[model samples]
Target chain A: MVSRPVGFEQQASSGALGSVDLGPADLVPFDDRGLAYGDGLFETVLLRAGAPVLWEHHRARLALGCDRLGIPFPCQDALDATWQGDPTAELEVLKLILTRGSGGRGYAEPESITPRLLSRRTPFQPVVKRWQEGVRVRLCNLRLGHQPYLAGIKHLNRLENVLARREWRDASIAEGLLADSAGRVVEATSMNVFWQQAGALFTPPLDQCGVAGTLRAALIDQGAVTQAALPLGELSAVDQLWVANSVQGVWPVTTLFSTNGSRLQRWPLPASDPLQCLAHPLLGFA
Target chain B: MVSRPVGFEQQASSGALGSVDLGPADLVPFDDRGLAYGDGLFETVLLRAGAPVLWEHHRARLALGCDRLGIPFPCQDALDATWQGDPTAELEVLKLILTRGSGGRGYAEPESITPRLLSRRTPFQPVVKRWQEGVRVRLCNLRLGHQPYLAGIKHLNRLENVLARREWRDASIAEGLLADSAGRVVEATSMNVFWQQAGALFTPPLDQCGVAGTLRAALIDQGAVTQAALPLGELSAVDQLWVANSVQGVWPVTTLFSTNGSRLQRWPLPASDPLQCLAHPLLGFA
Candidate 1:
């Protein structure tokens, strides 16, 4: 497996519509609709053993987002071009951002869209301690706004997550839990959450709000997980809890805390780790 | 008086976060939270006589968004640097995007946020005919999602607006009205809408959804308008309807069409134009 600290390198190019002449510009325009209106979609995948983990899943999610956002998305060839680099980096991070290129000063889709494909590689980072020892997460005060039209797909309009993340600053709190405007628990700030009761997996449905994470999708489709509208007051009902994402894999929780730092539930482990025997090799220590 | 066809030109540079040494590279990193998560805010202002038309108002609104989004905003001097180029172009549009710069993946606020300030100039295209003889607008099938925390601030995350604008493709339709998910009439695709009734001005409250347009704010603060939770079925009761923004100033709506191409209401212009004595000079042609 690859291993290195995260160091970022960027490259950008124009695609599809042929209007933008990005010409090897390694930086994106500050005015990219992605920045100006969060008018884009992205996928971050882990590079293990010098190969992108879950590349197909990432692509599928990107396509889903493009269809939902009505963006003429970058196809497989364009996405493959972004995976350029030496295979020797061992472990690295890969990010792909597909923006509606540059648009006029409004929200309307441009008549001709040159989907801007921006990709970058960074040193792979793993929350090693949290993965092994377990992480402590707290509930956030900021509530996610419900938008079915814009929910599920991992599109760029993420100010809600930013605001929710800002509600707490303790690095000790590995993640923050966010609830929808209707008080249904959704996800951690950056990852999808799953709970295990009697050894069956359950996750919150993202139909109202929250990103339908690639890994979460895989688990659910594989029958490894089920959807449920978990409430904030029911944390104690879980036999175990975990939050996961592609880059960092699955991290079991030691405790889930309320907004005021009161312990709501505890999922202490046996002398052995949980996911070690459960998750796929790519998702945890094999 | 200034007039010209709208054309766009753009240039990007590094901002207060000297961490970025932007040169001929002319690109932002893919890891830029702006693209990754739409972690940014923006302002589009009218440049009349080579000056930003609601200069103070735009700045104030930007500041409000920065404070809300928690981005360390670029000051006035940084904003001024983005307004370079010509003084002779009859009119040009200026757009500024402030992002949380580059950061690690996910929604968490970066440990060090060097806000990036990106600005561009585009030729100003005034809707001359629409200004003279009011334009026809249609109601969009897409509804805006309500997020009270993000309401009123012009932060980036405008996917709803993009989707709503796509509901209609008729060139004859100058604009479209978007309501929140709760059926409260909010705004046009790109402008704040106001209706005149009994010689008093009323606009939908933006507390649930919609941008608090600079011109709308100006009119409200100047005691020229009042806020209401206008429902979709009540448009016919208004004496006059208008949509306004900083760049286009204001345009009276001669007709508003339903999503299915049905006429909803009509406002025929007087032999002597109405609003001649009502609208401020900055808003319309007297």
Candidate 2:
């Protein structure tokens, strides 16, 4: 095992001091592997009353990502200390980005890595309207490529999602649903998706592609959801559908549109979605 | 088309003041989309005697990537200015990174983007020995996922290459060959692969996946190479094999090993390889 650099520990602790503004302290070296090759992972945590909701889940996922990429996980004390902030805001968004640090030109990892953890806090923009009254989502023309090795972890290589999200600029369309190259349903642009069939909850299996979200994990752990392969063709037959993430709680998808902007499927307003009900409290949603 | 931001032009022109040191001027803001979501493209140009090799090919690829991603291409005047440097070094590596500048916290791009172009020049470490005497390579277990939309563009989402490069630490192994999920030969960890079959040169098609190397494009343009779907199983039947990129030129594969380190195929030293002979002068190799 490669030994962690002492300088990294010190730098990380101090850098984790957290930033409210994009000052000099918030700048990363231009050669950072994160920017050069997307060699990193990130977490977006919702801060309610200054406490990070589902902090443990975020931490665990980050650790998992670090392990998969072979980057040394930063000290937990440093992370906790960095996460500490004033309890003034009613709601905030804490974004944590962990990168393999700066490296010389090439794809090889540096002899000794100085992992950098950058944290920024911004006021959370509430999507209560979408959360209350379902959202309209469309099937993206872009299909996600399957790389099992990089699957499930929310790594920094997200050009696919960026391209997928760029498919729709219509304000009415809240999200774009992505499918694997094989036509299997994966996830939405920034959230995990779930559908109900015969009163059973099912979400796409992420072994091939797509991120395994924290909110989706909590539901599975609580026995409210099961992993299954949902083909794009099978979506129209599902009873109910909802999209969720750690910060956005759950937004029911009321309308599904084809790539050409014509509606393919529509569902009635979710009067009471058991899946959303089970997730709202955990995500700190009203 | 989105109107190009004036600040970006000013920033690009100034930021291109080539830096040999990582100073405050060389730092990228943490919120830059390149670091956040790998929303960027990059080019590694070889400088032999202070002149960039295959410059037009590199510029065209970067522009193609920007157009594909809907990022406003940086002004050509700014890019040309940024590329100017003190023509002193015998051999230098110039890396240009163009990112969809800083954005608010989300996958959806900001209403207006200020694209950032980062350039750095470093002394090139010539792999003369690897170039002279063919190098040994092995097949990587990590298969590249096929994303047609992202195929062929040398974008910043290169975690696959990073992971594949990390698979083997044995310095003796010059590079690792990667195959697509369908077991079709794609490329090496950091270079493009070409092999001779019945006296015809063939390289993998980049439509499904793989970075279409500028050097590879140059070779193809000259009719020295043709694109074909190469199955991994057919490597043993090939008469000659070589891996190449702009910076490293062409390195003939002396040995090919399986993922487990067992010899899968071997090729005799090229007493006179026409492909390498065709590529040597273009790559500034003796």
In model 1, which residue pairs have backbone atoms overlapping below 3 Å? A2-A90, A2-A91, A7-A123, A27-B27, A27-B28, A28-B27, A28-B28
Output the lDDT of residue B198, model 1: 79
Residue range B15-81, candidate 1, lDDT tens digits:
3222333344245666667667877778887776567776788888888888888777675556765
- Worst-scoring 10-residue span by lDDT in model 2 chain A: A9-18
- What is the per-residue lDDT of model 2 for residues B154-241, given as tens digits with 9 covering 90 to 100? 9999999999999998989999999998999999999999999888999999998899999999999999899998899898889999
Off by more than 4 A, model 2: A1-24, B1-24
- What number of clashing residue pairs does each candidate have, in the order they appear? 7, 0
- Candidate 2, residue A56: Cα displacement in angstroms equals 1.5
Residue A275 lDDT, candidate 1, scale 0-100:
44
